[model samples]
Structure formats: structure tokens, C-alpha cells
Target chain A: MVAFDFISHGFIQKALIGGFFIAMLCSTLGVFLVLRNLSLIGDGLSHVTFGSVAMGLLFKLYPFYIAIPIVMVSAIGIMKLKEKTRLFSDTAIGIVSSLGIASGVFISSIAGGLNIDLFSYLFGNILAINWTEVLVSFFLSLFFIFLIIIFYQELLFITFDEESAQVSGINVKKINTMLYLMTALTVVLAMKAVGVLLVTALLILPPVTALQFSMGFKGTLFISCVIGVLSVTAGIILSFFMDFPTGATIVIINFLFFVLSLLFKKIF
Target chain B: MKETENVISMQNVYFSYNSAEVLSGVSFDLKKGAFLGIVGPNGSGKTTLIRLMLGFLKPQIGDIYLFGQPAFLFKDWHRIGYLPQKTSFSDNHFPAKVKEIVALGLLSKKRSPKRIFREDLRIIDKYLDLFGIIDLKEKFIGELSGGQRQRVLLAKAMVNEPELLILDEPTTALDPETRERFFDILKEINNKKAMTIIMITHDIGTIGRYASNMLYLDKRVIFFGTFESFCNSNDMTEYFGEFAQHLICHRHDTGDIYKKSYGRI
Candidate 1:
């Protein structure tokens, strides 16, 4: 009854709905990223989001709107640089990541201290998600899920054997670019539920947990999404009752799932 | 496609990475339905040459034509199957079943949102059985042994029924018995299906027994001719030294024969 009443509140309801979708999207994409050894792309892009949000604040623009394009374009640029330059992928990501955090601190300090609104964005506030954000997050998540499902085979082939895929005429470059863009978009949208710092945990942990038990590609994919959604929902409710921060709680729940999976693998 | 037409043609191809030249003044032509064995020592531009043929890498100064069209513009990739040098997955938790991996060959040729039709499933089954891996279809690829994994990848490449099959050091991970069986399968495919095959291997004797032609490469064209001519040519003596005949006749499976024949290669 208490859980029901808590969810009956409009903001809480919105958070639950949006949180579920974001979880599903992040974990689904995470499987591919993990398989391709590109898990740090999420971390790199989320840090880029920090700079964009700060710039938006200083310019007196809606930070959400400003962060979206800036984060996405920066994500594409980082990926391109990684591919083209002599720097390794980790080095490229490190460069972008440090630049992002440094610029964000500089801009926010120039404007003033990290205010309440900016702090909320940094750490996340599930209860603060309005209906517009909820609707947009829902549809975008749905569209990305649909795209992933339809392209599972090609994506799997590319991830599994990139050289063979290129020889077989699967435009590897185009597919890679599309994946990077979608990852950036998901990181930006998932901000309200997990914030910039913890969004990568959402992207990486569920897939890592699911990989412990899954025997095949399809099994890993659906199972990852399932684990993600369950963790997010459970985290939201538990945080409400336990009076903990929702974002951190969700990440901790995901971490717990990963630990449990490790134990389960060892035992079985 | 005339029977005598060149399926792959490389004319004075030159390739370099940064400042280092990998292939300089390399030239060769593979005829239709011919089994061309590409043999070379390590770091001899064997893989790089194949990459150029597949259009994965562009040559700095040469022309490469596939089926009479330039390699860059020849878009009918469904007619070609490629198995790369590295069969090992970087990720330990690679989650793909044998059947799913085989099905990727056909899926790579299709448009997005492609469905696995009943016919496609039948084809997958046919190739799995052909590779004697039908019972292992549901097994995860990561769980399989090295030989079994190679068979699964071979099935994946054959599922599309490509006219040209290219394998790079395919027997690297296989046991001797499995390697023999693999060579037999390739020979059978080449003879029965009349498929053109280009294979890269370190085992010259084994490949020479099955391959119709040979290309001995080391950053340039050392020799390109029929296996019989390769055996008789003075170029063989110049390249492999006095043990050229021993290298051709002695199976590497016997202890240290290949190493003794090629000394520090």
C-alpha cells in the first residue's frame, strides 16, 4: 500500500516509467559495447555531457537541450579521432574525458558555485523528471530497442569478426558510427535517472551480470535488458522506502546483481 | 566469366603503412576455379596482399581487379567468403551459438530488419552437417574446442555458398588429423563445386598436394606458377635454398622437418 501510494504521485510515476525504459536501452547497447571491447565509450561520452551541461547553464539556455547535441557531436568526434589518430582508444577517451571535466569545472566556476539545479543534474533526481522528459525518453528508448533487435545479426557479425564483415560488404564504418551516436543519446537521456557519473554503471553492469548465465547471443541480450529493468524498478522502490539517493541506489543494486551472478556461476 | 578469365588480378601493387613499405612491386593473377596457395614466411605481406585483394586495404600504387572489375567497385561480396587469420575472440564471454554464427554469413548479405526465413535455416543446417558440426549447433562458440571453433567458422563461411573462399592460416589452431580433414574438405569443395579458393598457409607440402597453383611471396613475387613448375623451377632453389625439394616433399607434421628445411625462416 505504501509503495502504491508513493508511485501514485505524478513525478514518481514518471520516474518509474522513464527509468525502466532507460535501463532497457542502456543494457541492450551495453552488450555490444562489451563484446566489442568498447565499454569505456559510455564513460567517455557521459563525461562529455558534464561540459555541455555547464556550458548550457552559463549561456542561460535549457541545459538538457544544450547537452544533447553537444554530447552527441562530441561523442562522434571522439570516435572519429580514435579511429584516425595514432593515439589508442583509451588515450583518446582519456583526452576527451579530461577535457570535458576540466571545461565543466572552469565554466561552472566562472558562473558561480555549482548551484542546486546543476547539482541535481550532476547527481540525478528521479522525482524531478517532468512529463515531457518522460515521454521523450520513452519513445527514444523504444526506437533504439527496435533498431537493435532488427540489426542484431549484422551487429553481432561485425562485433564478432570485423575483418570478415568488411570482406562480406557490411559497411562496418557506418554501423560503428551509428552505434556511437546511439550510445551518446542514451547517456544524455539516462541522466535524470542515474546522472552523468553513474550512467556508465547502468550501461555496463547489467550486461556483465547477464553474461555470467547466458549461453548464446540472443539469450545474453534479452536477459541483460530484463536484469536492467528489474534492477532499476527495485532500486526506485527500495530507495523510496530506505531514504537513499535513487541513482546511487540503482547502481549499487546493479553491482549487487553482478556479485550475485559471480557467486551463482561459482556455485553452479 | 570465361573459364580461363582471371578472377583476381594484381598489377605491380605497392602498399605501405606510415613510412614502412609492406609490399613493393607485387604482381599475380589467379584464374577462375583455381586453388591458389599463398605461402610466405612470417611478416612477408601475405595477409596484407589478401587484404588488398578484398579491398580492405587500398594499394598506394597498383591496380587490383576482381572478376574484371576494380576491387574497390566490385560490390557482389556475397560471392566471396573470407575467414581471417585470427580465430581467437578477444572477449572471453563471446555469447554466440554455432548455428547463430553460421547464420551471420547470410545475414551479412541482407538488408536491415532481415528475417531468417525457413530456407535460410535449411541452408545453415546443410552447412553445419557438411562441416560435421550439426550436433554442436546449439553449443556456444566460446565453449567449443579450437578444432570445433574452426569448423563452426568454416560452416559460417560456406553457408552463403560463396564462389570464392579465402582462408588465412586456417589450420593454425587445428590438430594434425583435423588439419588433414580440413584440407580434404577444401579440395573436395574446389573439385566438386568448382569454387575458386585462395588460402594462406605456412605448410607448403600439405597445401602443394591440394592446391593447383602456388604463389611464393616475400614482400614481392618470388614465384607464381603451377605446383609442378614450382617444384622444378630454379627460383625454388634460390628462395628455399638446397632444401627446396625437402620442403616440398616432407610433411611438417614429422618432428622438426619443416624447421630443418627452412632454417631460421
Candidate 2:
């Protein structure tokens, strides 16, 4: 039987709220990530964050704050390198993403013996969320959502055809760099609760499922969020019952939704 | 739609990439309401010239003006619309609906969110209706024939009600009927809407009859004037003859002149 005291059980409530916000941001941003043909970028950059977080832990710094700035700078740096090299975004992502995984493993090994709990960073323990983290996630999610709404048109144009976007007065290079940074930031935030390895799956799977059968951008966003909600709700329930990892379970649930969407698209 | 000012002008333009010169001392002036068709062989700088005029790359020498402003400025470029050589390079599974693809053109003008502006909607409707494919709007773009996708792209280019419309090799992938239909639409737009157009293509047949001004660019401004003068050029006897032969031979089922000339222009 569950305890009746809701206010005192802030951690439980906070985890749920954090899930809601994380679902909202990742799912919405996932649409753009998919549209730009950069779903892999989310996966790639999350590894970079993994490396950065490991760096923080090695230096005994607060991992989230330290990882945030590093992720932001590296996102911008990778974008700049892409522009100068004129490579496809995927190739650039490949290079940056590999750098992340390689660096994370390299630094952690050399710094000291690995802490077993540090392995939990691969997939988060959402059940351990505290009040401050929950509040921060909620507002950051809301702010990111608002910013996305404001620049929705610009982002769509850039995604559709970057040269056309530029010709129509959009500063596409700036917007492109900004989007990579946004993806990096969103992944960094989610890592606190969802963790690094699983955050990308959460980011991509929901929107990709929605896009398989949806029409308008708004429809895609709405459907992705709905799918995200279902995954989170089910993941939380499954975690409670099965004694499973919450973050990994959420990602798996969303992946199941993606598969279902693919099947439905085929059948329909 | 705006007054026919000097929409694009270039002077003594020189361009190159890694020491191989593409455009050498080429100068051309495109006024408002002119349909300038640039025709040349493969690797003849037709695409490069358009890129230069669009300010995709700066000329090594001279200057280009767009909407009376320097070409490099961001606001100066907003007055233009561009359609690439191919609409999309998809095999069989591109996920965009035709309507979704058309909406991308309108995306540039949206003032708030991803909402379609009323004017953009009107333009989309007008263009789809103008091209007589309003029914194809909800269909998947990948499911479309090449011609249908080209029409959708045309709608996208026109959604801005752009002052200058630039197309690179627009009709290459189309069947003959669709190709003619596409040109007819362009001709009508030239007559009625007075939209300035710059068409760059290797298909000399489309250029011979329709081009108001011809810019026969090789490595430089080979010829820049009316199509009549281009056809009458001492050198174009061979170029036009080959193209005219191809054109006539294509419509030869109706016992056109090509049958008598044995596909020799």
C-alpha cells in the first residue's frame, strides 16, 4: 500500500514532474531533429555529454553544471567545423560523437578506479530525483518549449531546405548552430534524470513514431508528446513493479511505440 | 509584384574555385519583369552564373546588386526565391506529403510559431490552383511522378510571391507534355504577373522559343541578348541547329518539319 502523505514525499512527486517536463522537451525537439535528418545527432551528442560528465566527476565538480557549458561549447564548435569543412551534418556528428565516447572512456580510466555507481550515469535513477532538480527541469523544459514555439517557422524552413531558408532572409548558419546547441542542452538536462545513453532514445523515438503517420508539424508535436506521456507513465509503472531501471525502461517503452508506429504505417 | 526596379545586376564578374576560372569578365543586367534564360552545355557555367547572381558565392572581381542593395546583405536576399535543380532526391520513401512540402515555402514568411500565415495560405492555394493540381496536395511527395513533384516545387517557389524566381534545370526530369505545360505556366506568369525569372538549363529546346533574353555563357559572357540574336549568332548555327533538330524530332509523330529534314536542324 502507498503512503498517503503527498507533500512530504516530495522526491516521488518531483521525479514524476521531471518526467513530464523531460517528455515535453525531448518529444518536441525530436520532431526537428528528425526533420533535419539528424536523429543520430541526438545519440551522438549524448555520448559527448557522457564524456563531459565523466570529466566533472573526475574533478569532483558538480557534473550537471559543468557538463552543461561543455556540451554547449562543443555543440557550437562542431557546427562551426561543419560549416568550414562543408561536410554533411551526419559526418560532422560522427566525428564529434566518436570524440565524446572515446574521451569519456579515456578520461575515466586514467583518472582513477571506476566507481560502480558511476556506471548508473549510463541510465539514470529517476526515482532519486530531489526538489531542486525537479523545479529546475520543469522551468527549463517550459522555457525551451516557449523558445521552440517562437522560432518554429524559422526552424521548419531551415529543416526543409537550408539554402531556401537563407534566401528567404533566415540566417540559416546561425539557426543551424543554435539548433545543435538546443539539442545539446536538452540532452544535458535530461541526463540528470533519464541519464546519458537513454536520453537520445527518448528524444528520437516519440517524434519519429508521430511523424510516421502524422500530417502537420503541430500534429506531429502533439502526437509525439502523447506517445512520450504514454511511455513515461508506463515506464514509471513498470519500474515500480519489476524493480527495473526507470530511464532505460522509459526508452524501451518509447522504442516499442516507434515499432508500433512503423507497423501501423505499413498496415495503413 | 513590386515595381520593376533593377532586381539583379552584375558587372565584370569573375569567378573561380581553386584557380579554375568559371566566369571570366561576365557582365549582365537583369531588369524587373524579364525572363532571362541561360543556356549552355554541361560544365558551361550556367549553374555557376546563377549561383553568382544569387550571391551563393562572391565573384572574384566586380560587384553584384540585388534589389538595389549589395548582394551580400541578408535583407537584400529576401526578395528572391530559389528552386534547386531537382525537387528532391528521394527513392521511394520520402515521408513528406505534397502539402507539407508546399508549406515549406510559406514557412519563411510565418510571423509566429509554425502557423501558416493567411497570405501564405492564399499564395499556396493560388499556385496549386494555377498549376491545376489542387487534388495532389494531400498526396505523398515521394509517391508523385517527377512532373507532379516539380509542380509542387513551383508552387513552393511562387508562395513567396517573389520578385525574382530562379530555377536551375527545372524541366530536365519531366516528360514532354509535362515539360511543355511547365513552360506554358512560366510564359503565362511572365505575361500576367510580370514576375522576373532566371532559368538556367542545358536543354536548349526549352530556351530557343521561350527565352526573352539569352545569356549563352561558356567561361564568360559568350552572348547576352534576345534569343533571336542568340539563334542568329555565327557560332549558334551549329548549337541552334542541333537543338532545333532535337525539338522537331521530339514532336515528329505529327509529321513535323523534322521528318523532312531527317532529324538534322
Candidate 3:
């Protein structure tokens, strides 16, 4: 009866669907990103998306469309800069991230200063989920999943041993660029569920928790997705009953699960 | 030997990093199944030479060929298996099974939605069996001993049944017994499977026993010839100084090195 009551609410239903899809996409990319030691790239790109979203809002254009291309290009740019300039990975990420937040602050200040519309993008308001946003989230999430599935083995090879992958004719540069693009896209789409600031947590926490179990790569991936989806589902329900912010609730739930996983790892 | 029979050929190959020259005028030709031990002191570009041959890095000057094709155009990479030096990024917390790591070799040969055929599994099993890691295939690779992890990495390299295998300081972390066992395995792969090997190491006394051809490199081809020639040549004394004969003869005497400069004893 309680489940039916919750499902009957349109906004709640849309949030649940959008959250699940975002969780799926982020968690899948999370596994490889975590393993490749590029987890911070997710954080950096999300901040970059924040700036793009602000610019789109300032121009009265669709934010997702504007954010998607800019974030993807920035992702590849960051990787190229790191390689060509020999900057440390974190140093590159830090440089891009500061530029992102500064641009967001500057644009938002000029465009009437953190309006309700911008606030939703900054901290996430799942209650604002509309039919069009839901559809966009679904397609983006599907695209991310399909891309990863198709290049699953190639990604694995490159992530585990890049030299061997290149030597074995895997076209590592192309695959890496594709992976960066997918990660950027996933970070942007995840903003609907967790807001730009917290999207990296959605991308990293579940996979980090899954690593506690010491399962094989496939198993780890499966468990990470499960953890991600389960956290969002539980957090949404709890938020509905307790009247809490949806995004923060979901992230806190994920953190709790990570702590629990650590306990299990230590005890077992 | 015919030019086509050379599995790897480098002529006057030079590589530099910024202003520093890592390799200069390096030249050698490895035959179809010859085991080449590339020996050099630290910072002498032994690893750089291997990277050049593997096409991981390009030579700034001269030319290199793999299986008769120019290094850049050599599209057939699965034919070569490589084990890099032990000093790599290792996260013991990462969850990768031994079998999964080995299967990466096969996966690297394919695109994804990879159909893991029975043949692939058979190849994986065959190499796992060879490395005596069949029991640990399901175990976490990170949890294994350094020796066991080395074998898993080797299994990954050999899973595709490569025509050429290259290892850089593979036995550096292994104990004496494990190191000897590893060499024995290399000998088996070299003799029985006829897989050509190019190993970069400082263990001259040990590699002297296995490598058919030896390249004593110090930023260049100090000597590149048969093991017998390497032992008898004056370059041996030139490279190792007064201890050259002692180092070479130590192999027959105790099969160990007394000098730390040549690598671990």
C-alpha cells in the first residue's frame, strides 16, 4: 500500500526512474575509472559541466545539450594536456576544475546570481524532473551502457595494461578518447540525480565499495551497479518518508554502504 | 641468415628524451628464435631499446623493423608478448582474478562483446597449466606472492602463443630458486615452443646460461653477438673492467655474481 502510494505520485516516479538510470551509467564507468586511477577526472569534469550548465542557463538554452559537448571536449582536452605537457594527472584535473568553478561563479553572478533554476543544477532537485529531462536521461544512460558493453574487453585490456593493449593492436588512443567521452557524458547526465557537485561520488563510491569484496572484474562491476541502484532506490524511499533532500540522501546512503562494506571486508 | 628470418632488426636506432640521449646508434638483428639478453648498467637504455622494439617509443633516428615490416606499420602485435619491469603501478586493493588477467591477453586480440570461445578458454588453461597457476586462476592476482604474480603476468603474455616474448628485469624480485625456475620455464618456451625472447636484464651471469645471443649495451651496441663471442671478446673486459673474467667464469663456478653493479646475486 505504501509502495503504491509512492508510485502513484508522478514526480516521485520520474525521480526513481531517472535516478536508477543515472546510477547505472555512473556505476559502470566507475569501475574502470577507479581502476585506471582517473577517478578524479569525473569530479573535474562535473565541475566543468557546472560551468557549461550555467552558461546555457544564462543564454536561455537547454543546459544538457550545451553541457554535453563542452564536457566531452574538456575531458579529451584534459587527457591530451596531461599527456603532451607531462603534467601530473591531479595537477591537470585541478587546473581544469578551478577554471570550471570560477567560470560558473562568474556567469551565474552576471545572470542574476544562483536563481532557483541554477540552484537545482547545483544541488539537484529531483522534484523538478520533467518528462523531457526523463527521456534525455534515459537515452544518455542507454548510450553510455551500450558504448561500454561494446568495448568491454578493449577497455579492460587498456585499463589493466595499456602497453600490452597498444602492442596487441587495440588502438588504445581511440579507446581512451572514447572512454573519456563516455565518462564526461555520464557525469553530465548524473547531474539530474545528484547535482553537479555530487555526481563524482555517484561515479566513485559504488565501485570503491565493490572493491571491498575482492571479486573478479565482472563480479565487481555487477556488484557496483547493484550497490549504486540499491542506494538510490533506498535513498529515494527514505527521502520521501523523512522529507529530506533526494540527492544528499542518496549520497549519504552510498557512504554508509561503503563504510559497511569496509567493515565486512575487515571482519571477513 | 636471410633478412626475412630476422624477427627483430634495428639499424643505427637513436632515441632521446628532451635533451638527454637515452639510446644512440643502437643496432642489432635478432633471428627467428634466438633468445637475446640485453644487458646494460643502470640508465644505459636497455629498457628504452626494448620499448623502441615494442613500438612503445619511437627512435628519433635510423630504422627498426618487426617481422620484416617497419615498426610503425607492423600491425600484427598479438604475435609479441611483453612483460614490463616490476616497478609498475600495483594496487593490491583492486579486484582482478588471476584468470581474468590472463584472459586479458586474449581479449587484447579482440574487440568487445568478445565471444569467449572454448578455444580461448583452452589457450588460457594451457598457459595457466604451464605456469603452475591453474589452481590459483580463481584467486585474486593482488593477493598472490611476487613470484606467483610474475607467473600470472607471464601467462598473460604467453596466452596468445606469441612468436616473440620480451621481458624486462622479470626475475628481479624473485628468490634464487624461483628465479632459476623462471629461467627453466623460459628455456622450455624457447626450446619447445620456439618462441623468440628478448629479455632486458642485469643478471648477466644467469642470462649467460640461457640467452643464445647477447647484446651488451651501454647507450649503444657495445657488443652484439653470440654468447661465446661475448665471453671471449675484449669488450667483456672493457665493460666489466678487471672483474670481466671473474663475472663470466662465475657462472660456471657458482652461477652467481659477486658485484652488485651487475644486478642481484
Candidate 4:
């Protein structure tokens, strides 16, 4: 049995609270992205966040202030590239993702090498989350989640059929841009908790696991959020006791849930 | 809202893709309550014309109007119901139910909150029953067969009971019996509700039996008039030859004409 003493630490509390909000946001957005065949967008935007973070560190500025705007712009750029050109969405994502990582490497070399600060961002250090980040994630997640609720029907319509939704008087372009912007914001917030490399795992695994069950869209969304929060909670506690990386632990737990869901689908 | 006599109006519409010139000098006016069938061969701009009318594509040198408003500026979309060629929900595991899919039809008329009240559910069920799929309301859309899926989508399109309905090759993947039933439903809606309808189809032979006006198009408007005129027109007879033109126009008249004219063919 593990002692409850670690629960009193402010850092652990911050990680738990912040991680919960981030997990909820990622999983909620993941459902739409996966259904729309835009799952790779999370991975793509996270790489852009990496380059922005490196630029911030090189300039001695707060990373998120730079990372947020840059990643958002890159997200829109990926969308516009796919629209203007005849390339498929995956190809566009691949192009943007390659540029992001290549630029990060170039910037890092120009700054001499990858330092401990950048390394922390590369692998994540959720325990170092401050009170400000906790509040920010909480409010941001709540705000977007509320927006999702208000536009829930419109989003579902567009995901099902874009042309029919357009005929229904939905501004398909505006809604699509809003979706990309929301994804960019989620990617930036999730980066601090899971790092650039593992952010996609958080955005993908929960919704996919929920999809294994034969349920309605709303049911799938609800189950995805439950899995997300559960994994984060269990991961933070297990990492505290087992001395494992919190981000990796959470991702692993998520994968385990996915595998179990597949097996459950097979058995029942 | 003031009523418009013409449901759609297009004047000298010209469209091209990469200078290929898919459609040129296309002009037509569809009055209210007219059932118009747009038939053409593949790559003949039937779909493009539909897209332009729906404002999905703009013409380089023509004006299009819907309900007397410019097509691009028309905002009363709730008055129009559309069924595309193929829905993206064709994936075998698309996680949406029949009821949920049908509910999407009523969403366009809603305000920001857009909540589906109990009355909306009743309307959805009524449509499902009309389509004979009320029992499948809770089933996933992907789990249904092609015919059932078409019915569900038709229900979705008709749930709003719009003033005008547009269908793009909606029966492309169904059996002949299912297609017949589908057209029967459309005929009923067109006759009973006096709804204006524009359907693009490859079933040129069968479309004449139901559509009041037939627009035979090949890039430009080859013919746009009532089926009676098309049957009696010497130009159509010359263009399609006696056998083929009679084959299309025969069904519009009586079986006696089909037997007397093209029975030996």
C-alpha cells in the first residue's frame, strides 16, 4: 500500500489538476479530429510548438507566449495548404510537421545545443507545473469545452457531411477554422504536460479507445472523457509511487485501456 | 417572408475547370412547384450545374438566384433541403445513430443553442416511420444496408419539410426496387406539398415518367422544357434520332405510343 503523504505536495497537486484539464480537452477534441480524419493534426501542431519553444528559449522569453501564436499560425497554414493545393490532409500535415522539426533542429544547433530546459519540454516535466499554468489550463479547457457544447450540433453536421451542412446554412469555412484554432490551443496547453512528442498520444488514445464500443456519438464522447481523466489520475498516482515518468506513465495507461477495450470488444 | 414565383433562375451561366469549359451559356428558370429532372451523361456538367445553383461553385459570367435572392447571398437555407451524392458516413464504423442522423435535418432552422427538444424527436420519428425505418432509429447508420441507408438519408433530407428539395444522384447505389420506391416517395412529396425539386440523375428513361420538366444537358442546355414539348419537338427527334428520342419520350405519354412507335425496336 502506498502512503498518502505525496498528496500534500503542491507540485503533485498542480500536476494532477492541470493534467486532468489537459486530458479532458485533448480527448474531447480528439473525437472530432479522428472522425474527420484529421488525427495527425495534433502530432503536426505539437512539432510546430516544439520549434516555437526552442525559439523562445533562444530569445530568453517565456515559451508559451511565443509557442501559442506560432503553433496557431502553423495550424492554419496546414489547413490552407490542404485547401489551396490538391494534396490530401495527411500530406499537408506531413509537410508542415517536417518543416517544424527541421526548423527546431536548426534553431537548436544555432543555440549551441539542446539544454536541460528544452530537454524538459521534449520529455515533459509535469511536476514542475506552476499555479498559473494550472489556472490557465483549467480556464482555457472550460472555455473551449463550453464552445464545443454550444456548437455541438453544427460540428456533428459538418463532420458527417460538409456539403449538406453548407446547404444547411452552416458556415463550413468558419467552423473548420474554429476547429483548427481550438486544436492549436489544445496542442499548446497539452505540450507542457506530455511534451511535444507524446501530445498526440493524449489526443488520440482516449477517443480511439472509446470508439471500440458500439455507442452513439455522445456516448463515445462521454466515455472518452472518462477514460482520459481516469488514466491521468491513475498515472499521476502510480508515477508518484513507482518513480516513472508521469507523461509516459499516462500514455502507457491509455494504451493499456485501448488494448483492453479491443479485447473487451472481442470477448463481449 | 414574401413568396417568390420562381424557385431558381440562372442566366447565361458559364463555368470551367482549368479552362476545360464544363458548362457554357446555360440558362433556365424553374418555377415554384415544378419537378425538374436534370439528366446527362457522365462528365456532362449535370453535377456542376447543381453545384452552381447550390452556391457551392460560382459562375464566371452569369447570375444565379434562389428565391429571388442572389445564390451566393441567400441566407434562408432552411427553406432548402439537400441530399448529396454520397454521405461521408459511408464508413462501416461511423458512430452515429439513425435518430441522430435524422435530427441533423432540423438543426439548420435552429438558433444558437440548437437543442433538440421533444417535439423535434417526434418529428424525426415521424419521418423514420414515413421511410419505414422507425425500428432502426437506435441502430448505427453504418450497420444498415445500402437501401436502408438511402432511406435514412432521405428521411434526414425531408425532415425539415423545406419548400425546395435537391437530390444529387441519391439512388446511385440502390436496387431497382428501392430506386422505384425512392422516386415514388419523391413524387408524393412533390405532388402533395407542392415542393419545388431539382434532381440530377442518369436514369433518363425513367425520369420522364415522374419529372414534369426534363432538362437534357450536355455542357450547354440541349433542351429545357416540358416532357410533352420534348416528346413533340422535331429538334429532339433529330438530335437523338427517332428510336432513342421515342424511347425517352414514350414513357411520358401512354404505353400505346411506346407500342405503336418503338415496339419493333
- Please name the candidate that would achieve the greatest DockQ relative to the true structure: 4
Poorest stretch of ten by lDDT in candidate 3 chain A: A123-132
Docking class of 4: medium
- Over B3-58, each residue of candidate 1 has an lDDT whose tens digit, in order, gives 33888999999999998899999988888889999988889999999989988789
lDDT of 2 by residue, A1-268 (tens): 3535532466667777877887888888888887677777777778888898788889888778778888888788778877788888789888988999888898889887457555777787777777777787788777877777888777766766677777776777777777877788888877766787788787889987887875566777888888987898778767876888888888889989989999999999
lDDT (Cα atoms) of all candidates against the true structure:
0.84, 0.75, 0.84, 0.88
TM-score for predicted model 4 compared with the true structure: 0.95
Per-candidate TM-scores read: 0.94, 0.88, 0.93, 0.95
Candidate 4: lDDT over CA atoms? 0.88
Measured against the true chain A, the candidates' chain A TM-scores are: 0.96, 0.93, 0.96, 0.97
| Model 1 Cα shift for residue A55 (angstroms) | 0.6
Instruction: List model 2 lDDT by residue over B1-265, tens digit each.
Output: 2333787878898889879988889888888889898876788888887777767888889888877776765375446778987432343444566766777776555444557656666667778887777899878776788777888887888777777899988877778777777888888887788889999877665555566777888887777887556545666657558676345324324433323434433
Look at candidate 4 and tell me the lDDT of residue A4.
Answer: 62
- How would you order the candidates by lDDT, starting with the best? 4, 1, 3, 2
Question: In order of the candidates, what TM-score does chain B achieve?
Answer: 0.89, 0.82, 0.89, 0.92
Model 1 alpha-carbon drift over 4 Å, by segment: A86-88, B1-4, B244-246, B249-265
> In model 3, what is the error at residue B92, expressed in angstroms?
1.7
Structural similarity of chain A in candidate 1, as TM-score? 0.96
Candidate order by DockQ, decreasing, is 4, 1, 3, 2
Better of 1 and 4 by TM-score: 4
